[model samples]
Target: MDSYELAIRNTVEVVTEDELKELLKKPEKSVYTGYEPSGEIHLGHLVTINKLMDLREAGFKVKVLLADLHAFLNQKGDMEKVRELAEYNRRCFEAVGLKGKNVEFVLGTDVELNPEYQLNVLKLAQQITLNRATRSMDEVGRNMDAPHVSQMVYPIMQMVDIHTLGVDLALGGIDQRKIHMLAREYLPSIGAKTPVCMHTPILNGLNGKKMSSSEGNYISVADTEDNIRKKMKKAFCPPEIEENPVLQVLKYHVFPRLDSITLRRPEKFGGDREIISYGECETSYAKGEIHPADLKSACTEGLIEVLAPARDYLGL
Candidate 1:
């Protein structure tokens, strides 16, 4: 694929593909995404990380903002706790192949604490109404019924993050679309450059539901081979192609990393098969040529292979 195609691959949408094309022509350009420092890094986070890697491959400098302060402000935890989570999240990101010459990791506190950064944030706060800010965090804010003051400030900080990082593009999952749109709309009001935005689809879990820690339906890099097999055995893989979580893993997580996936089964079960493309896999499954059991097994094997490097790197 070409640079534009690679940049936009597996993405749900780009705010303005034309603007992204124009920005790509510049010799020097950068892109970034912010993370809220969760306790565990799973496939949910990998979607954006994979896109960031693509942007890096396309020669755009990539910045990962470990938003420790934002995590704290959003009431994830106290300052120290969120900061520690940030460090672990950084290590996990590197283990998953984000480390390289073109990638730079920035802490939210490092630049966010700067007087100038704070001043810009305050100015933005004045212009952004509570209704707009609250709307922007609909997909991200912790508690919405009666939100804390800090939750209201989170989106503005995000807008400032784009300006402070000086990235030409901002990348994230579709959940962040509202926030990115807010940045595009309001950043110029604060005399900051608006960022072209890219977003990837939010993959559902093995149960065809939201990937949440409480559900334990998602796979993590730290999972052992045996653990993966166990989870795969119980994964919800319906016959249909549209909402099949196993196929989603194949399409979004597996195919993008590996060239192809080979499903090994006995001749009695149609013998072994090599799927060269996600389209072929989906088509085969949809046609009933591929059984759901076989589909989940292949996804399990592919996931283990893809996450192996991280397992070794972390010595887990």
Candidate 2:
């Protein structure tokens, strides 16, 4: 695929298509995605990491923000704890093939503590109402039932990050659309350029529910081969194609990394077969040509192959 196609592949939406095409022709361009240091870097986080890799291949400088301060502000952990998580998360990102000269890792505290960054954040805070700020953070903030003053400052700082980093585009999951839209609407008033936002679909957990760390429904890079097998065996794979988590994984994570997937089965069950594309696989599965057991088995082995590098890097 060409640069433009590569940049926008698998994305749910880009704020403006014309702006992206114009930006693509520039001699220099940059894109960024921020992550609040979490306990586990699951497949949900990989959605954007994969996109960042695509952006790098598309000739854009990629910035990955390990938002230590953002995590602290969002009540994820204490400063020291979150900073430790930031370092670990950086290694996880690198282990998953996100390292290169063109990709720079920026810690939130590195640039966010500057006086100028603080001033821009406060300036934007003045224009954004409390209701708007609260709503913008609905999907991201922790303990929103009774929020702290720090939670109100979270989204404003995120907006300033786009300006302070000087990136041409912002990439995130669809959960971040509200915050990105707020940046597009308010950044121009402060004399900073409005950012072009790209959002990817939020993948469901193996059980076809919202991915949550508390529930242990998702796969982490650190999971062992045995753990992967056990989880995939119990994963919810219904007959329907739409909203099927197994198919979603094959579409978003597996096929993107592999040329094709082969379904391995015994001689009685139509033996083994090879599928070359996600579309063809989906069509065949939907037509009942492939059984659910074979589908999950293929997904289990494919995910293991895809994550082998990570497993080796992390010594898991």
Candidate 3:
């Protein structure tokens, strides 16, 4: 596929396809995705990381923000703990292959605390209504029923981050679309150019429900091979192709990194088969050409292989 295709594949939406195409033509393009530091970097985070890799291949300078301050504002943890998580999160990101000269890792406090950033944030905060800010953060903010004042400032600060980073495009999961839309609408008013926003789908947890940390329904990069096998064994992989968590793993996580996936089986059960593309794998499963057990096994193996580099980097 071409550069533009690579940049957009598996994405749920690009705010304006025309805008992204235009930006791709420019010689020095940059894109960024911000992550609030968490205890573990799971498959949900990998979706954007994979997209970042694609962008890097497409010749865009990539920026990953370890939003420690944002995590604190979102009530994730105390300041010291959040900052600690940010450092570990950066190492996790690099372990998963988001490193290199073209890729940059920035701490949220490093830039967000600067006078110019704070000034712009305050300037924009004055114009955005409290209700608008709260609504923009509906999907991202934690415990919004009784939100702290810091939560309200989160979205506005995020808008200013686009300008502070000086990136041409902003990449995030679909859950962040509301906040990104807020940025597109308000940043231009602050003299910053409108940002091209790209969003990827949020994959369901292994249980077929929303991916949640408390539920332990997601797979983290730090999972051992046995852990992956155990998780896949229990994953909710329905026969139907749509919304199949295992197939989603193959499509979003596996195929993006591996050229092909082989499903090994006994000779009596259609023997071993090599699937060249996600579409083919999906079709075979839909037609009963591949069984759920076989598909899960293949996905488990593929994930193990894909994460081997990370495991090695982490000495796991």
lDDT winner among the candidates? 3
- Angstrom error of the Cα, residue 265, model 2: value is 1.4
lDDT of 1 by residue, 238-285 (tens): 887787788888888899999989888899988999999999998888
Two-way TM-score contest, 1 vs 3, winner: 3
How many steric clashes does model 3 contain? Answer: 0
Tally clashing residue pairs in candidate 2: 0
TM, every model: 0.98, 0.98, 0.99
Q: What 10-residue stretch in candidate 3 is worst by lDDT?
A: 132-141
Q: Candidate 2 — which residues are off by over 4 angstroms?
A: none
Give lDDT tens digits, candidate 2, residues 1-316. 8999989988999999899999999989999999999988988998899899988988899999999999999999899999999999998998888997899999999999999999999999889999999999899888899989999999999999999999999999998999999999999988899999999999999999998987799999888899999999989999999889999889888888888889998999899999989999999999999999999999989989989999888877
Best-matching candidate per TM-score: 3
Clashes found in each candidate (C-alpha, N, C closer than 3 A): 0, 0, 0
Q: After superposition, how far is residue 226 of candidate 1 from its true place, in Å?
A: 1.1
Query: Where does model 3 exceed 4 Å of error?
Result: none
Global lDDT scores for all candidate models: 0.91, 0.93, 0.94
In model 1, what lDDT does residue 70 have?
Answer: 93
